[model samples]
Target: MKLLKTDGIVIKKVDHSEADRSLTLFTKNFGKININISGIRKSKKRHLNGADLFGVSNFIFYKKEDYYILSSFELNETFFDLRKDLEKLNISFHILEILNSVLVENETRIGLYKLLLNSFRFLDKNNKPIKNYLLLGYFLLLLIQGEGIMFNINDGLYFDIENSIINDLPTFNKLTEIQKIIISNLFDKKINDIVSLDPSVDDAKSIILLLEDYMNYHLNLKINFKEFF
Candidate 1:
């Protein structure tokens, strides 16, 4: 009976009825939600792009009993360029997959939402493959931080995976020099300055893979990004 409006990005979509579709959106106020949109599949022209994955839009909906039914939507951004480049599209989906995996339904994560939007905007504008990987590393670090695991990368000697900190002595998880530098810079530098690090593709992947381990240990998320690489 109550109409609600919020800014959301489509993270998943699936065919429902012949004319309706089901979508999973990560909204600014409500976090992840599943809503059914009618007539989109049959009449694709009016609602197709707005309902597509990775498009940010303002959505209007209302709850009917237990289901949220879509009333309308206005597309804000499609991040169209991401669709043009295969690699960019792959990387973007990788980020989205992580988001879809970690986000609990109806739990608001304002910081993570902002980080996701900004990372998409950044990835949309930049064409450098290395920069894209660096952004992925940056996004992953922030995602971990959002979970309250602060990674202390000061002059990195050894990473304490158990405590999620960096220390002078060797720990069970040893980080390479390049991985240490990349992690430190990602946390310390601004978005514009990240590209200045200009890490090799391999180096960038090393940092991301290291962070992936942290994700598994701390968050219990096992994401295999091998296909994207």
Candidate 2:
């Protein structure tokens, strides 16, 4: 049997055989994978609980046929502070939901993996929920770019959502100037730099909605992100 190790964050978990858990993780070395952890649910160890949703850990696994079974793990960031605020918690879940939706299994997305860690850090450390709303937009913008379906920035003034393009003429789904700017900032600026732009809560929400539509259209994935924020 081959043993493998990676830094991974649990994105989803399912109960199995009463005490075991099937965890879906987005990892640094491997993009997304599913591993089975035995006795974690019933285990009294505090460290084992780190395998819970959104928890980052250094995971060791051994292959059993085509499946990977958990061997041991070292706990990393849980970003537990995000749970202190409802909006922040929701935003974090929203990001994870999108990740679960789009990331291909066994594909290497190191950039997005790093981005997820950074996003969690930003959400956990920052006090402003409004900025987090924009941060969600930033995550989605980069996600779209990472998927290689993002709209062209240099092509034109109006964005065509259906075609994922920018054109001289306006389309039915043309983004407003402010909306365009927000996307640019989210894509180009640092998390701290986004605060200088000072987007209102409403502005952030609107841009996120736009991004949702863009993602749905381009990726053919339905994400009902409205309930989160």
Candidate 3:
């Protein structure tokens, strides 16, 4: 067995036994890996907190054949404030679910992990009516990073979702000038600035749906959660 120590984010956790959990972690060095975390349930207060969904930690584990066994973990950030509101919590889960679905095991995506962590921090700090849109923006950023899409801010060009390029303007009957501006800015603006804009809930939802479809088409993965609203 090869022992390793690294920083990771908890992507998913499932109870395997009375006191053991099967966890999926996205690590800085090792990418995503499945690990068996024992004794969490028995610890109740302490270990349980470190193993929560969206928890970032420094973990010690040992690799054995195909899987990793988690020996110890030090909690970094739980993003606990997200739990204070039900809606925010739901949005956070949606973000994690998308990542869990797309990110492959043993594929290094250190940049994506950093983006997710920063987005979670933004959610915890900011107050915006369209919180889901902010998360959707981060999702779009990840898609752009993974797909190698070009974003041109100065020209106000839109992404040809099918081609994954910023050449053609978006063609949707319902999109207004303001909505187009918002989408353009999404492709160009800084993460913090984009999240601070207060678009109406309906408008935000519409943009998010369109972007989700674009991502689905490019990634060849159906995003069924777009129908949640």
Quick one: best TM-score, which candidate?
A: 1
Q: Residue 87 error for model 3, in Å?
A: 1.8
lDDT string, candidate 1, 1-229, tens digits: 7899999999988987678889999999999999998888788457588999988999999999888999899999998888898988988999988888889999998888888898889888997898898889888888887888776765556888777788777787777766677777888756456566665788888778878888888888888678676
lDDT to native, each model:
0.84, 0.83, 0.73
lDDT (Cα, tens digit) per residue for candidate 3, span 1-229 = 6679989988899997788888998899889888997778887556576787888899999988877888889999887787786767767777777788788899988888788888788777657647656566656665656766543433434545655544445533245555666677666655455555656777666667666776677677676555444
- After superposition of all CA atoms, the RMSD between model 3 and the true structure is 3.1
**What's the true lDDT of residue 217 in model 3?**
76
Q: Tell me the lDDT of candidate 2.
A: 0.83
Top candidate by lDDT: 1
Q: How far out, in Å, is residue 55 in model 3?
A: 0.8
Worst 10 contiguous positions by lDDT, candidate 2: 151-160
lDDT for 167 (candidate 3): 42
* Ranked by lDDT, top first: 1, 2, 3
